[model samples]
Structures are given as C-alpha cells and as structure tokens.
Target: MTAALHGLLTGLTLIIAIGSQNVFVLRQGLRREHVLAVVLVCLASDVVLISAGASGLGALLRAAPQVVAAARWAGVAFLLGYAVLAARRALRGDGGGMEADARGTRTGRGAAVLTALALTWLNPHVYLDTVLLLGSVAASHGEQARLFALGAIGGSALWFTALGFGARRLGTFLRRPRAWRILDGAVAVTMLLVAGMLAAG
Candidate 1:
C-alpha cells in the first residue's frame, strides 16, 4: 500500500508538467481529431516507460554517465527547437484558420500515435523521471517494486484519460484563431523554460 501510494505520487509529479506533448494532446483532443488514438498512444507510452523504470532499466541508465550527459544535451536541443517552432506559430497568430495538411488529416491516427511515442521516447527528462527517480525509489521497496510500478501505470492511465477527455471542452474556447495563438504562445514559453531548467541541471 505504501509503495502504491508512492508510485501514484511520483507519477503525478512527473506527468503534471506542461510540455509540448501535453499541449499537443490537449489541442488535438479539443479539435476532436484522432482523440482516442492520441490518448491510447500517450497512455501506452507512459506504461512502457514506467514499466521499464520499475524493471531496473532506470538503474542501468543512471550507471551510464556518458549516456545521461548526451541525453541531457540532446533534450535541450530538441526543446529549444520545439520552442522556436511554437514561437513562430504564436507570432503568426494563426490557429483554427489553418487546416491540417492532407497527409496529416488523412493519417491523423498514425501521426498522433507516432508523435506520442516519439515525444515520450525522445525526451531525456522522461528517462530521468521514470527510469532514474521512479525506478530508484521503487527499488528500495524490495518486493513491493512491482506493486509500485502498477500504481504508477494506473496513475498514468487515469491522467491521460482525464486530460484527453477534459480537453474536449477547450474546443469551445479555442475555436477562434486568437485563442489558439495565445495558447501557442503559452506553450512556447513553457517549453523554453523547461528546456532551460533541464540544460542547467
């Protein structure tokens, strides 16, 4: 029970951050575009990562200082690039007026799923949080490690479901291009800040 509670708390702490992926998922949810697929992708990715962390991969990762260093730098670069793209969109101040490309619209499910996977895998912080932090914590529990992992997985599932479905209401407010621009701006700033922190650490 204690392990489960700890896992739940850890999952919540890691997943609650405002990142590019979260923003993207929320926007997609609001647009009602491939919502189910997106949610599944997010949840599945979380499960995989959290499971790996609980299974001792986190310790392996922490053991490799070089890999962690590389990942940190790579993550910083990715975040900066993403922030630039988001900032560009914000500056353009265009939103709902812009329709998705034919390819994106037609392959929305595949795109969203792939994007979610990539976002989960590519972010170095995910490793730090899931593999290092969560894994290390769970490991201390000895036999309860598995239970803690299950609890973390449950937390992830619950969060994604709530965020994806709750974002549907955002459609009402984000219908206007102006609202979308504001959201983009906010996302851009948040990403930049996260990137900065990651790099500094």
Candidate 2:
C-alpha cells in the first residue's frame, strides 16, 4: 500500500539519476541495438539487488544507526559531487561525461550485455542506492517492507523499459549536444534535491 508507493517513488528517483548505466541504456535504445538484452539484464540485476536490500540487509543496517548515518553522509557527498560534475558537463560540454563512451562503435550483443553488467555491478553507488538507502527505507516501513521492495522493483521495470524503448523517439532531438546539456542540468537538479532530502533525514 503506502510502502509500495514509497518504494516506487524512491526507486524512480534513484534510477533516474543520470549515470553511466543510464546513458548506456539510452544509447543502446537509440541505436536499437540489443535493446531487449540490455533491458533484461538491467531489470534482472535490479530485482536481485532490491530484494536483497529490502528483505534483510536494510534491517541489519537499521540495527546500526551509526552505520546508517555514515552512509547518509556518504550519499550526500556523492550526490553533491555528482551534481557539480553534471553542471560542468552542461557548461563545459565535457566529452568525458556520460556521453563519453556512449558514442563509440556499437558492440556485439555479448559485449553490450557485458557492458551493462559491468556498469551495474561496478558502480559503488548502486550499492548505496539499492542495498543501503532503499533497504534502510524499507526497514523503516516495518511490516510492509516487502511491499515497498516490490514497488521499487516495479519502478525499476517501468523506468528501464521506457528508457530502453522510448529513447528512440528522442534520438532526433538528443543529437544536438545542447539537448544533452539540458539533460545534464535536469539530472543535476534531481541529484541536488535528492541529496537535500537525504541530508535532511
């Protein structure tokens, strides 16, 4: 119920953060290259991670308030730092930003899948967002924690499916580097707002 919706909203907020994984997915979607495989891999990984966080790991962290505080601070730091980077990307048109590796020659299905895996598993923030933050929130939900987790999973499915498939429509507009700057600006704002929320909690 409420937990489910909370999970869904939280999940969307975190997943929508512009990052390597997201950019990669958007690029693949635009190229219409192995979209199904990329989407499936991302969705499956989220299921496992979100379940692990909501089911138990979150509770463990809850038992340790100090640890949760530390994570909260770390998240704030990461979010602020990321926001700065995103702003710079928008202003400077940094080639090393999200679109840096986005435009190279397309890889085979296997490579694309592997890249998706790497992008998901390699990022440290994934753990922070899924296992720590989401888990911690679900733990706070008490009896309805499972519902929260499921809702988060639903968010993940909804976002990835839309990003992977719907991005094709935006392919024309995103071709302009200014559109990317605007995208980065929006992401920066989202990150700042989320960071503010985390810091306040």
Candidate 3:
C-alpha cells in the first residue's frame, strides 16, 4: 500500500504538469471530437510505458542516447509544426465550435488518434518521466515495483479521464470565437516553449 501510494503521488506530480499531450486532449474534449479514443490512447500508452519502466526497459533507454536524441529532434519538429498551425488558427479567428469551416476544420478520428499517438510517443520527456524517473522510483520498491507501477497507472487514468471529459463543462465559455483565439494563442505559445525546452535540453 505504501508503495502504491507513493507511486500514485509521484505519477500525479509528473502527469499533472501541463504539456503538449494534455493540451491536445483538452482541446479535443472541448471540440467534442473523439474524446474517448484520445483518452484511451493516452491511458493505454501510460500502461505500456509504465509497465515497461517498471519491468526495467528504463535501463535500456539509458544506454541508448541515440534513441533519445532521435525522439527529441522528432518532437521538436512536430511541436514546431503544430505550433505554427495553432498560431495560424489564432490569427484566422473565424472560429465556430467544432466544425469544418474556412478558418479551420474539425479533424477526423484517424487524425485525432494519430495526433494522440505522436504527441504521446514522440515526446522524449515522456520517456524520461515514465521510463526513467518513475521507473527508478519503482525500482526502489524492490519486489513491490509492480504494485507501484499499478498505482502510477491509476494516477494516469484518473488524470486523463478528468482532463478529457471535464473539459466539456467549459463548452459554453469556448463557444465564442475570441475564446478559441485565446486558446489557440495559448496553445501555440505552450508548444513553442516545449519545443524550445526540448531543443535546449
């Protein structure tokens, strides 16, 4: 129980930090587009990553700096591209809620899922957090590492569920074009910052 609780707290501490994945999930939720799918991908991803970490894949990752570097560069490129799109959206400002229009179109399910995957898999920080930091912590639990991982996975499940579904309550506020502009602006800035940080690191 102690291990599980520790894992839960640690996972929450890492996962609750605002990042590209969370931002995408929140946006999809607000748009009411493939929320279930996106949330599931995120959860499933956490399951695999957390499990891999607990099972000692973290050690392999540490030995492979090249792998980390590849992911880092990929993430920088992806984030930069996404940030540009978001910036354009902010500039266009012809927004309606979750529809395909001249300014922007609602993405299809496949696109959403692919995005969820890219945002989840491409970010090197995800690896450092889940596979490195969390794994090292779980390893300290010795035989109870699995339980610790379970607790961490539980934290991920709870957070993504709330972040995705709970965003609907803000629909009223987000319906305005200006609200979307503000959101896109914020998203653009956040993406740029993340990319910059990843590059600098």
Candidate 4:
C-alpha cells in the first residue's frame, strides 16, 4: 500500500510539469479534436515507459552516464528550437495556423494518432521520467514493484483523462484569437523554462 501510494505521488509529480506535449494536448482538448486518440496515446506511452522502468531498465539508465549526457544535450537542443519557433509565432501574433489544415480531411484521424504518438515517443523527458526516475523508485520495492508500476500507470491515465476531457470546458473561451496568442506565448515561456532546467541540471 505504501509503495502504491509512493508510485502514485511520484507519477503525479513527474507528469504535472509543463512542456510542449502538454501544451499540444491542452490545445487539442480545447479544440475538441481527436481527443480520445490523444489521451490514449499519452496514457499508453506512459504505461510502456513506466513498465520498462519497473523491469529494471531504470538502473541501467542511471549507470550509463554517457547516454544520459547525450539525452540531456539532445533535449536541450529540442527545447531551444521549440522555444524559438513558439516565440516566432508569438511575435507574428499568428495563432490562425494552429488549426488543422482542410487539405488533409481524409487522413485527419491517422495524422492525429501519429502526431500524438510522435509527441509522446519523441520527447526525451518521457523516458527520463518513466524509464529512469520512476523505474529507480519502483526497483526499491522488490516484491512490490509490480504494484508500484500499476499505481504509476493509473496515475498517468487519470491525469490525461482529466486534462484532455476537462479542457473542453475552456473551449468556448479559447475560440478567440487573442486566447490563442496568449496560449502560444505561455507555451513559449514554458519551453524556455524547461530548457533552462534541463541545461542547469
């Protein structure tokens, strides 16, 4: 029971941080576009990563200094690039392009699924949280590792479901272009802050 609670708390702490993916998810949730697919992808990715961590890969990651260093630099570069793009959009005050293009109507579902997958899988922080941090914590539980993993996965599902579905309440308010601009600016600042944290660590 204690392990389960610990896992739940750890998962919540790691997942609650703001990042590009969260920004994308929030935007999609507000738009009410492909929300189910987005939630599933996010939750599934978390499950896979947390499971891998529980299986002892977390210890392996911790021992590998070079790999962690490489991931840090790569993550830094990605965040920096994302921040610049967001800043550019903010400066242009162009929130109009945030919507899906009309030309790809037929493939919208597939595209949304793939975008969610890529967003979850391609982000290095996901691995850091699930495969390393959560993994290491679960490893200490010994016989309780499986229970801890379950709790972590449950926490992730709960968070994404609430975040994606609950965001719909803001849909009416987010319809304004000014709202988009503000969101984009917020995203830009978040990206830069995350990058600074990663680089500093």
Best of the two (1, 3) by TM-score: 3
**Comparing 3 and 4 by lDDT, which wins?**
3
Off by over 4 Å in 2: 58-105, 173-201
Ranking by TM-score: 3, 1, 4, 2
How far off is residue 22 in model 3, in Å? Answer: 0.7
Q: What clash pairs does model 2 have?
A: none
Candidate 1 lDDT (Cα, 0 to 1): 0.76
Compare the candidates by lDDT and give the number of the best one. 3
RMSD of each: 2.8, 6.4, 1.7, 3.2
On the 0 to 100 scale, the lDDT of residue 184 in model 4 is: 71
**Regions more than 4 Å wrong, model 1:** 97-107
Per TM-score, the best of the predicted structures is 3
Per-candidate local distance difference test: 0.76, 0.78, 0.91, 0.77
| lDDT value for model 2 | 0.78
Clashes of 3: 0
What is the TM-score of each predicted model, taking all chains together?
0.85, 0.65, 0.95, 0.81
Worst 10 residues of 1 by lDDT: 97-106
